[model samples]
Target chain A: MSLVFDMALVAGLIALALHVVVTRDGRGAILAFMAFGLLLGIGWARLASVDVALTEAAIGGGLTGMLLLRAQAHLVRHAAHPAALPTDRRRWLVPALSCGLVTLALAAVVLAFPRPAPSLAHQAVASLEATGLGNPVTAVLLAYRAIDTLLEKIVLILALVGVWSLSRDAAWGGASQLRPAIIPEPLVFLARVMPPFGVLIAVYQVWVGADLPGGTFQAGTILAAMALLVMLAGLRLAPQTQSRALRLMLAGGPALFVLVGFLGVAVAQGFLSYPEAIAKPLIVGIEAALTLSIAGTLALLVAGPPDRAPEP
Target chain B: MSAIALTSASLFGLCGAALVGIGLFCILTHPDLLRRIIGFNILGAGIFLVFGAVARRGAAMGLSGDPVPQAMVITGIVVAFAATALAIALLRRLASLTGSATLEAATPPRSET
Candidate 1:
């Protein structure tokens, strides 16, 4: 039954992928891609990567889909008719042949991946006690691989800056207006109904992440989604990008992460090193702060750069 | 060779390889910037799937998969989203300024009808 399921999933995944690639309309392709993300999340779960599954489903499917959908809506005015994409089907032939060969090579290589597949599972497990985390993946993320997580957070910040800078200088630091031209009654209702539950789920995911498959990324995404829903529903105003409180929230996680890293040098072995006795608390603290920053960053990212200047 | 090598891990790994191919084809053949961005994500997901397969095959210590790779995949997914958002931002900016979504440098920007 399981093997059959996997086969069906793979078939479905491939079909959706092809659909996204060939769909002439941008919105259709994006919606298909969102479905693809959710399916891929399930695929990750099947592979026993629960953390990855959550992240894929949340960020990959939920947030990215929203971003693309909004962008598509904005750009559709330019393409009254779908862009001339399917002109010559034969044009895909050469590229298709090339991609086929690449796939063949990759498949052969994957099949031959050294038996017993080189892995860090044991090392990750061995160091788990030091991190005071039950989930080896969380341990790997916050303990053994602290620097990567730190740098990744900074990368997100930098990307947001890049995104924000694209707006006109006068509109810089303006408020993100998520109000659609005509708000649907259902969306407004959803916005009112959903956020309370979403917040609780997000908090639960982060709080228990140290021992489970949930973590900051997934939690952050859920919070981001909820925040977006509220703003989109026009229940609450989207915060100004230049609001000091918003900026502080956006940078606080990484800032604390950096401070903690430097504190490691004074208190423990080196940067980002936690005293074993307090490791879990420290990791969780960082995660909690990071979750807030990530949520704000991601929500604003999807809401996109500020469009209108703040009222005087 | 491990007996498990012939299991679902290998199957999904092969599946991932196929996705990478499809993504590459989309990126190369599609004229639309939006489709190309989506293609980039498909490519990233394929690579992560391959990583997932590796993580699963290495399961040990009562765990179902390797923690290290799973952590990496989680991080990769977030980063990929960040990059995608940036790309979409750039694309929208291009569309607003030039009135064209595709970057055909030799040709003039599409004039508003």
Candidate 2:
């Protein structure tokens, strides 16, 4: 029964992906990709990676889809002219054939894998007692692989900078205009009603993440979505790129994270090491700060580079 | 390939391979930068799913998948997203400057105001 469900989910995932690639209408393809992301999330769940499934759904399906859709809307409304695609029959065949070859090669590789696959599961769980994080995945992220997480956070901040720098000189240090020319009634209502619940769910996820499937990425995505909802509905202004507080919020999590890592070198085992006595509290505190910063960064990312010129 | 296996890991592994093919096709052939960005994301998802299948094969210690791979996938998903946002921003800027969304050189240039 479960295999049947997995088969069905994979089938849907493949079909949606095909539709996204082959569709002529740009908007329709994006919508299909969103469905594909959500289905892939379920596929992850079946593999017993619920935390990944949540990230796939929230960031993969929800946030990325919103960003693409917003970009589509912006391009459609402001393009100097409709850019027509060159339809070349010969151009299509090479990519199609090459990609098919790649797929067949990869499929063969997967099928040839040896039985009794090698893994780090035993080591992960065995070392879990000291970190005090019941969730092994969380341990890998915040404990065993702290440097990667810290660097990833820095990468995110840099990406935001790259996007912001794309703005015109006059619009530098300004805010993107996210409000629609006319707001819809339903959007306004949902923006007003949804955030309270979204905040509660995000908080719960961060708190339980040390012991369960939920964690900072999923919670941050949720909070970002709620903040986006309010911004899109014109209920709240998007932050100006020049705002001092906004810059601080964007950098706070990683700053605190680096501070702890250095402190570890002096007081604990080494860089990013936690003293066995207080590892849990230290990691949890890091996650809490990260959650808010991630939320702000993602929300602003989807909001795109600022367009409104700074006040004279 | 020696007679195809029916394990869930193998099955999803095959699914992921096909997705990579489809996404690569889109990226290589699709003219619209935005659509290509979508293609890039689909390709990322495929690669992650393949890794997920590998993690699943390592299930033990009361965990369904290896924590290491799962953590890596989570991180990959977020990084992929940040990269996508950057790509979209660049695409929009290209459209604003060139007044065209595609890179093909044959499209006739427009007169500047």
Candidate 3:
């Protein structure tokens, strides 16, 4: 029964995916892509990685949908009418063949690979308990090799900053004033039901990660999803100016990381090395800050610059 | 069960690859910039599928599963989203400045588009 269900879901994904690819209207394609993300979230859950499942649902399905819809609204107003894409163009033949060959080669290589075995991931899991987190992934994220995750957060912030700077002088600020978008009644009903429980689930995922498949990333994703739902329903408007609190929240993760790292230097010999005596508290604090920061960064990505709302 | 799981997984993987190929075709053929962006998103989804399959394959081992790749993929997805947003902003700006609805066709000069 489970296998049958999995097959059904995968089939649905492939069908939607094909539909999305074939659609001439970019807006319709974007909506299909969002649906695919939700299918992917389900795919992950069925595969048993609850953390990934949650994150996929939140970020991949939820936040991404919001961003695409917002961008599509602008593009539709500005772009040409939908027409069948030109497929008779012969000049693409060589590049197309080359890309096809490359893709086939990659698929063959993956098919030939042996089953995975224990290594870095296993090692991380083995030593995870020492990190004062219940979830091995969380331990891997914020403790074992937290430096990588820290830099990643910085990357997200930098990307957003780059977007803001590039469009800063342009007519990007009128989306907030665009004609009030209508939210379908069904979606409004669903949004109201999902968020409260989603909040609880997101928090539960964070709190029990010491031995389970949940963590700050998954939790932040859920928070981002809630924000996305609100945005989609027009319950919230993209701010014309970012609030002071939003600014602090945006900088919170990096700031907290630096603050905690320096404190570690004061107490220990190296940066970010929590003293054995207070490791749990330090982990909890850093994780909480990271979660908030991630949530803010994701929300902003979907919201874009409140300053650049394109006039409807 | 494992055999069926592996097969279905392989099938999805193949579908993903096919999607990537079609998306590339769309990118190469479509003159509309927005359609090209859609192509890129399709391409990314294909790559994401490969990563998901890798994670499932890892489950076969009696290990606690590697969080590293999954973490990396999650991080990559977010970063990709941010990059896409930036691209959309730049593309929109480009569209407004030039008043050209078909930047893809104009760029390569008798090339792909």
Mind giving the per-residue lDDT tens digits that candidate 3 earns over A12-127? 87677667656766677778878888888887776555677777777767777666777667655765443455565575677579768867876775575565432365676566
Instruction: For candidate 1, give the lDDT of residue A168.
Output: 81
Q: Which one is best on lDDT?
A: 2
Worst 10 residues of 2 chain A by lDDT: A78-87
Over the stretch B49-93, how does candidate 3's per-residue lDDT look in tens digits? 666666655653364345666666666677677777777767765
Evaluation by DockQ, superior candidate among 1 and 2: 1
Cα RMSD to native, each candidate?
Answer: 2.4, 2.7, 4.4
DockQ of candidate 1 is 0.59
DockQ sort, best first: 1, 2, 3
- For candidate 1 chain A, which ten residues in a row score worst on lDDT? A78-87
In terms of lDDT, the poorest run of 10 residues in model 3 chain A is A171-180
Cα shift from native, residue A68, model 1 (Å): 0.9
DockQ each candidate and list the results.
Answer: 0.59, 0.57, 0.37
Residues B10-113, candidate 2: write the lDDT tens digits.
88988989888988988888767788899999889989988988899999988898889999999999999999999999989988888767676644432321
lDDT digits (tens) for residues A65-122 of candidate 2: 9999988887776564433333566878877999999999988878877777889999
Give lDDT tens digits, candidate 1, residues B1-108: 455445788878988999999999888977788889999999999898988889998998899998888999888988998999999999989888878787645332
Candidate 2 achieves a global lDDT of 0.89
